[model samples]
Target: MAEVHSRSSHRELRVQAGASDNVTANELFDIEEQRNRLSRMFCFDGMGGALLIEPSFPGCGMIDAGKGDLIYSNALYEIKAGDRLFRSVDVRQLITYSALNYVSKRFQIDSLGLFNPRVGVSATIPVDDLCAEISGKQSSDLFFDIVAAISSGDISR
Candidate 1:
């Protein structure tokens, strides 16, 4: 179980679990605190409008997309807290978010990036290059299929 505590402008979510567990309660608490700290760091007022934390995208359901982690003025950032190396799936996710942003015309996604603070590594791809790569892989059809399924609400097949 988890207990949420709110004090002033700070919020903490504490999970209670045994020490022997694979992920102990203290670990969960630490993770939540780190996330909150990162959120604060990327917050608009704190970052001088450089980044917006967890900005919502309207009509994301049309493409089965979710809110992105952070949004820079000209790009979208997906933060991976763990030390895991960046993968193709991560690139695909950012590309999909870029595509959705393009279609929505809310924010023109100039670039996409994967940031891993744990390892202090980052990779960025220009939206045009990403789109070209997806096209070269012939994956655009699959992406469109997903959008079609979501729009029709008949993903079952």
Candidate 2:
């Protein structure tokens, strides 16, 4: 956390980039706290797996233009920074990216993860386990459905 004072010059270098104005000391402190939490996050630095930051999404070898935040070992992780915790869309977004990776065959994705440093929470689920919860459909089956839809032009990438 940073010290909040009456001085006009705030050293909020890490909180926001490119511009220093319009940011309060409390926000900088909060972001620092969140950053500290992220640093303590589970072994993303080689112990877990090979870490790739903002990797390109080679979708279906045709659908170009999408980038993943991070890939650790076999899991694709999406980092979110917000005050809310209970968002299914965040999970759904990961699933979509996972589907893209599956169809593209660029990387071996075996699991999916969501990490929110602001709330100091992290979770990951195996792809197989997640697919098991989806009524009688494996990850392959579900992901293939997306590919099929994309192939048939029923959906936009």
Candidate lDDT scores, in order, read: 0.61, 0.70
In terms of TM-score, how similar is model 1 to the real structure?
0.58
Candidate 2: regions farther than 4 A off: 1-21, 42-48, 60-64
Candidate 1, pairs of clashing residues: none
The superposed Cα distance between candidate 1 and the true structure at residue 55, in angstroms, equals: 1.6
lDDT of 2 by residue, 1-157 (tens): 1122222321233656435787677877887888776555534343544556676776563355588787766788889887878478887777778778886687788888899888878888998787778636898898888667666765645
* Candidate 1 local lDDT, 10-83, one digit each (tens): 33445556634699666777676666555454442243445555755655454654688776656688888775
Flag regions of model 1 displaced more than 4 Å.
Answer: 1-49, 60-65, 137-154
lDDT score, residue 156, model 2? 47
- Number of clashes recorded per candidate: 0, 0
Which pairs of residues collide in model 2? none
